[model samples]
Target: MHSQQQGWAEQQDALAEFGQFALSCIDLDLILQRACELVARGLQTPIAKIMQTIPESDELLIRAAVGLPRDIATTGVTKVPGGHGSAAGYTLVEGEPIVSHIPTETRFQVSEVVRRADVVVSANVVIGATGEAFGTLEVDSLAERTFTQADISFLQNYANLLAAALDRHKAHRERVANAEERSILLRELQHRTQNDLAIITSMLRMEARRAKRSETRRRLESVGHRVEALSLVYRRLYVTGVTDAVNLSAYLDELVKRRFLMHGLEHDDAVKLDLHLTPVEVDHSQAVAVGLIVNELVTNCLKYAFPLRQGTVTVTLERVEPGKARLTVADDGIGMPDDQVRGHGIGLELTPVLAKMASGDFTLEQRDAGTAGHLVFYIPDLRGGGSKPL
Candidate 1:
């Protein structure tokens, strides 16, 4: 009874020491090393060791040890035997405490490791979130000494603590991996953007040099307007830290102002642009479509919407219903006949194909009082859902 009580007291003291050390602001490796040393001293044993299981090889490896050669203390790679296995292996397989008054002959251990030791017993405790066996708490004494139930229970609690630490280390590694992948993707996007910019710059140079008259030069300047619009989209995509939806209103305002400036149209010019648009969110595919459509419409308006001197162009865009939009490009200028309208711009034909691919409706209508074009189009939600008529 006295021995049992004394052992209990020692166990409590050891547990308290471990708790204090765990709470201390120390390195993780240092804390684990200290725990192994303390276990040997508290138990009055010749050897005390902590072993961790390697995931890939399914072998037990000693992480820290005391009262052994430096090389022996660091080595604990033990594989399961084809026949019967050691106490440590049995402890892990059965999830039960195993105690034996027998010597463990291991190829992983050197002769000098346990020369002064008589019987070396180990208590295996399952560690980690899924309760898989992680390692063992082993101790050896010069004389044969049976470990009590209380000793096994104390070691089990420590094993749980070690399991939590191992999980934290795993999580840290996953975060680092994710960060590296994101960096690689960002580099690839930048390379693609650079290539696209080079192509646009070449096209603008070629077009500018080929213009023969003031009217031709003014028409070619619209290409610069379109390129600047694309550049703005890319810039905002990077600046806002998003590759998704852009503020349509802001983009259009900036785009129109730049186009007017490129054609030498001052801010207080006779030409007035009235823009009325509802809020809309679009993915890259839709954004690209809308950008090209705007370029074509704006180019036509600048060329023939006004009598090169003065006029008003009202552009109204609205989401009439879910996945349905109505766009009207109207100008108080010389009206066009139905036959002339069909051959207005070749790009208008692509609108119907793109709309069909999106599972939407596309219609072109000519309004009276001006050469007005109404684009009634239904665009399916980029995310999901059926298309709606515009």
Candidate 2:
């Protein structure tokens, strides 16, 4: 009784260990091989095999084996004929457990693999899959021994565990495949959007060049700048492959570089960008809005602030509080000028609208020497598990 109880305890421990293995492993062959080792050791059988059903044939493939001859073990291409000829094949085809004691085992003809292994007793159990039999997990002993009801029960339960593991691994693979497909689609969409925006900006500039009115040209160029600002965010997103949030500091840094390149102001003698930006992350809407606002403010600075064409437009980002950030653009030139500070032009007039879109507000104040503008907006909880994140 004690021996039987000890065997039962070992089987239970094997099942628990197998559960952990199955959870972490997606490799089917490795899983089957491990299961063979466990079952063989648990049942005190020295030789074991896992043979899978061959499609539309009376044959089984030896997918994995332990404590068996090197020739009998699978190299991904070992097969045994089915239909009561071998224990593994019979169990797989019949979809049940079977035990054959060699002395009186007329139910099976000794196959070449088994014949060489010198098996005196064999126990085979079916490993199942979704709505069908997957294969057979069998154990063979060189010394004749009877597998008790409890022993057979342990084998059947282990087979059940294998069935569950196989299905779970299949599901995991499908999920990974689906995630990759989505990522590909996102990249394609971003590429097309960048191309579309490029065409739109080119057309606007072309129309501006042909216009008779200076105001008309300026307004068209302004619209093009806004579109260009929005487009840059998408371009950055495409390059980074980020789906949920955009890094604010990196985007702003790139924006300054872009502005310089667009108007041939990249030379050190021209208006330079003095960026002291702190890293922040926000959703798509805020990122786009923030980009546009920065472009407009900086454009106004370049258009009016510096008369000598040699000054710095300082852009700073600060985290004032949790879930809130402040972006400021300042210049030592002639100030924001005109009705821009009181909310007019593309920069000021749209400030309120854009700020609301970002779940925030905007303010402007003239310093002793230069003008400073601020847009305080919500920074998403990228860390999650909160209504808002710093």
TM-score of each: 0.52, 0.88
The lDDT values for all models are 0.60, 0.82
**Any residue pairs clashing in model 1, and if so which?**
none
lDDT of 1 by residue, 1-390 (tens): 997788677867876777677665246577667767767766767677666666765445666667765644454442332112444544555565555555654423322333433445544455543256556666666575667777767767666666665566556668778966875676468456746865785687577779778666654555565565666666655555445455554555666666666556775888777788776555545555566556556656666656655877677778877777776667776644454468544545555665554344555556555666555566545444221111
User: Who wins the TM-score comparison?
Assistant: 2
List model 2 lDDT by residue over 80-168, tens digit each. Answer: 88877888776765667898886567777767788788888888888885237878888898996889888889999999999899889
Model 2 misplaced regions, further than 4 Å: 54-58, 83-85, 102-104, 108-110, 129-131, 320-323, 381-390
Instruction: Itemize residue pairs with steric clashes in candidate 2.
Output: none
Tell me the alpha-carbon RMSD of every candidate: 10.7, 3.4
Model 1, residue 280: what's the lDDT? Answer: 59
